[model samples]
Target: MRKEPLLLLILIALILAPSVQGAKKVVYVAKVEGTITEYTADQFQRYIDIAERNNAEALIIELNTPGGLGDAMMRIVSEIQNSSVPVIIYVYPRGAIAASAGTYIAMGSHLIAMAPATSIGACEPILGYSQNGSIVRAPEKIRNFYTAYMRSLAEESGRNTTAAVKFVTEDLSLTPEEALKAHVIEVVADDVPDLLRKANGMRTKLPVKGKGYVVLDFTDVQVRHIGNSISDVLISYLSNPAIAYILLNVGILGLIFGFLTPGWHVPETVGAILLVLGVVGLGYFGYNTAGVILIILAMIFFIAEALTPTFGLFTVAGVASFIMGSLLLFGKGGGSIYLINRETFSMLRIAIIVLAVLLGLFFLFGMTAVVRARRRKPETGKEEMIGAVGKVVEDLDPEGVVKVRGELWKAVSKTGEIIRVGETVKVTGMRGLTLIVEKAEGDAEWQE
Candidate 1:
């Protein structure tokens, strides 16, 4: 009986030990919506780190974006390519687009899935302008180089090379069903659970260092979401063309206001913070150096116009330069390309032109007023009569009163020329409440 009890205990121990030794499988889902900026890159890196730390089975990135910066896209692609865990790109929730840079990211992923109503493609290098604002196009050579790079990524990911080329060269797009049929994507699913079901038992070749290839078996997986932090979300939104432009304008206007009227530190502080944020956002969007230089030149012109009267020339030139610079500020990347929208640019141009004209008029009037004030006669005490040419209003015994510009003032004569009432004289100096006068050379007839 004791031997039987011992055998039963051993059986239970063996079953429990196997259960304890087997690890629970997990699937990490990361959602990327909107423009993929530097914050997106940071978040992706963070999620990758998290996956690595937890030894997750795979990382699924649900991507919904119009596109973003080229450099950021390249960084993301590099990260995806180098990731040890299987990275799946899924375009979800229907009506979402994976244009430009998004195409590169999806192609870079180890596995790509799409929602039934979603579409992808349009990997063509748009040279200038975006849905958000205007952007300068890359040089032809550079664009070709990026095209070749994306092609290589497609090849590595086992996507259709011909279709990939068409995407870059012709801006071809594909719906989920079409993408699957063309081999641009692996599968189509309604949601994450369905994705997990379809993804389960799927095998992928891992790029392990020493091993030739390790197969991924994502069976019986636990799903863990990797959502963006509030800061990350804010950064991503602020990196948009519209938001960036607003921030840039606010920062510049605040700074100008602060400079014009000192002692209000709040505008300056806000301006400094906004300027930093705008610059960082522009950098994240891959702005050209020339565009930035042009913007600086525009600001210089604006300040110059404010300080010196340029007859509206500097103001006009500044507005023109600013519009052009803003139009060419950012560039298109593999995923998201930043460009100024046509309507926005047109409105901005009009506003800038109007502002310039108004400022020019204000400076013109203000400068004229200042010149007039400088030429006007002094209105204060005795010093006001120093250079005045006036007539004696009363007979003076070397000291009396005089009339100057319709005002009577106390006066005296330095040269002992007897001054009679109505005798014309010129002011030489003054004593408290008294003006010293000299007989006018050409006004002797008036003294007769």
Candidate 2:
């Protein structure tokens, strides 16, 4: 009787085994609805890892994007293609699109499904750093390469390669039904649960969760949604084209303000922090180097106009550089490429010009005041300077240093006389940065 009871228990356990496994079945879901970036790739990778570790049925990425950097898109594609768990890319939320980089990502997944009214394609490979990425025509070589690339991805997934090639060459776009009919996609569902139900028993060529060439069985599954983390939000904000641009400009202005009004460390300290962060974003995104240098130089020139004696030249140069740098500061390099559309670029351009003009006027008037201050004396016989007597702090070999009105000034000997340090001199005139100085009468103290 004991043996019979033990045998009955063993049989019962065997009968319940399949149901136990099915009960544990889960589907990990993550959603993306923005321009793709490395941060996006990182977020997706996290979800994929989670699903793989838990041995989930699939990790679905519901996406809606107008494309993004090529490098970032490639990473998303790579992770999806090589993942151990089944990766389903669903263009969801109805009326969403898998455009440009989005299309490439969708094609690389083990399974692709779409919601009603959702669309895909229009993924012509843009030259990484073209003047404008969206509408600009790519080179023939690039077109051919991408055509072949898309075809390869489609071929590998056992989808319609011809339609995939047209996505690059002809910029073809399709709705859910069209993609399903063309075999570019495998299923169309309204939502996550619906997608899982319809995708059951779907044949996938790529390996999933370490299994190969098998039909997926996703029924009565538990669903877990992986939302973005704090880091994701931070990186997404930092890498945004508009936000980054504003950060860079505001940081530059803050620094300028701090310089104009010294003795208050608040603006300088805050500006330094913002400027550092902005540079990191700009450089991290691969913005043009010349653009960055120009903007930095503009700062230097603006500071010089305030602190040094320049004849309005620095002010003009600063404004010109600011405009040019603003133009080149964004959408000029490859990684995280953005602000490529003409409409957006036009608005940015207008803002840059307006800011530059306003700044130019402010500095110009400020320089005029400096000129008037320098020319305070009667111009009857004097030329560029107020006559003031002071001591030489540095030796003058046609150029040196002097003190006038208890303030230091760069000076040059009026008559090519080499006056040693500690000698007394008279400020006869001033021009630009240099003060015209001459030996004071009855001056005795001099350095040998």
Candidate 3:
């Protein structure tokens, strides 16, 4: 009887041990709704940290993005691939997509799910600009390398290799149902609750840091949302092509205006901040170094115009350089990597050229007028005595007072002439506010 009781106790303990030891299931849902940026990386890492701290069962990322920088995308993929918890990428809430770098990220996850009407695919490599307003596409070899990389990622996830290949080779796209049928994705869920329910009891493989691989079976999953914060949303908006373009323009104009007026702290501050942000965006987007250099040169030209008289040469050069630089700023990354469109470029170029031409003409005209005015005879002050006919206000043997411009001034005769106070005289030169006078026409009392 005692041995039978011990066996039954052991059997009950074994049955309860699994329930006690199994990890509590909690799902973290992180949403990516716009352009992927460095900030996005930070947000993802933050959520992962939260999930790990809470010992969450898995993380579900609902991605809807047009695309973003390659480096950022790669970093995100690396994070997801190396995560301790299983990550599920879902194109959810309907009308969402996983395009460009989004596709890479989705494929990097442990599982990929899409909502009805959602789609994913389209991987293409884009290049930076050159110096002279030209767009250059990446070499075929490099493009093929990326294509192969994407293909490998897809294959690793057990997604359709053919469809993934078409994404890069032909830019193919498929709806959520089609993606499921094509093996590009696992399931379709209409919303987060449905997604969590479907994801429950799913087996996942996660690569531990030191260990090779660990199998995790999710049970009793509970969904927790990780939505974007206000700051993250703002950063996402600023990273957009249109917003970035506007910021760049405003920054450049602010800096220019500040330089012209000097001591305008607001514009200068705003300009500096925006310029730094714009540069960060440019670096993130892989703008051409040559084009960036050209922009720097254009700024130099404009500065030179403001500080020195360049006869409009610098202004003209600056305008031309700005147009060319802006044109070449973003290369032929197709729709994939382009920060600014062709129409935007054309508009910016025309606007800059027109503004520069007008400013240059104004500077030229104002400078010419100043030069001409200086060359003309002085109309007032000590300068007015030059070649002026005046009268000796006092007896001037060699030095005395003379009247010029209704004012009396110390006078000296350059021709060694003496004159009475009432005598008329002429001013030939000046020295320290002293007029060098000579006898007018026929003044017999004063002679050389």
Separately for all candidates shown, the number of backbone clashes (residues 3 or more apart, or on different chains) is: 18, 1, 0
Model 2, 371: alpha-carbon shift in Å?
Answer: 5.7
Model 3 agreement with the true structure over 355-385: per-residue lDDT tens digits: 5566556556754665566668767666665
Whose TM-score is greatest here? 2
> How accurate locally, in lDDT, is each candidate?
0.74, 0.80, 0.72
What's the lDDT of the predicted structure labeled candidate 2? 0.80
When 1 and 3 are scored with TM-score, the better candidate is 1
The C-alpha RMSD in Å for every predicted model, in order, reads 8.8, 11.9, 9.4
Please list the residue runs of candidate 3 whose C-alpha ends up more than 4 Å from where it truly belongs after superposition. Answer: 1-25, 126-138, 205-222, 256-264, 332-448
Global lDDT of model 1: 0.74
Q: For residues 1-448, what per-residue lDDT tens digits would candidate 1 score against the true structure?
A: 8899999999999989976655688889988888777777887888888987787788888899878767788889888777777788899878888988899889887788999888898877756555455555667897798779878987776779899888887789999989999988887999989987887776552353233344566667788898778887678767765566657766876787688669978887898788778787766655666666676677677667666745567767776777666655653352144454466456645654665456456555654665567669778766765666888888777788888777788888888667999778887888777788888778443321
Q: What is the descending lDDT order?
A: 2, 1, 3
Angstrom error of the Cα, residue 138, model 2: value is 1.6
lDDT of 2 by residue, 1-448 (tens): 7899999999999999998877688989988878777777878889899988888888899999988777888888888877888888999988999999999899999889999998899998774433454455677997887788788888888889889999998889999999999989998999988888889988775666457765787877888998888877767677765567667877887888887888997887888888777776554345677677888898789889977758788998998888778777764453235445666566666777878888888888888887788879664334524556778889999899887666688999999989998788877787777889899888433222
TM-score of each: 0.69, 0.73, 0.68
For model 2 the local lDDT of residue 244 reads 70
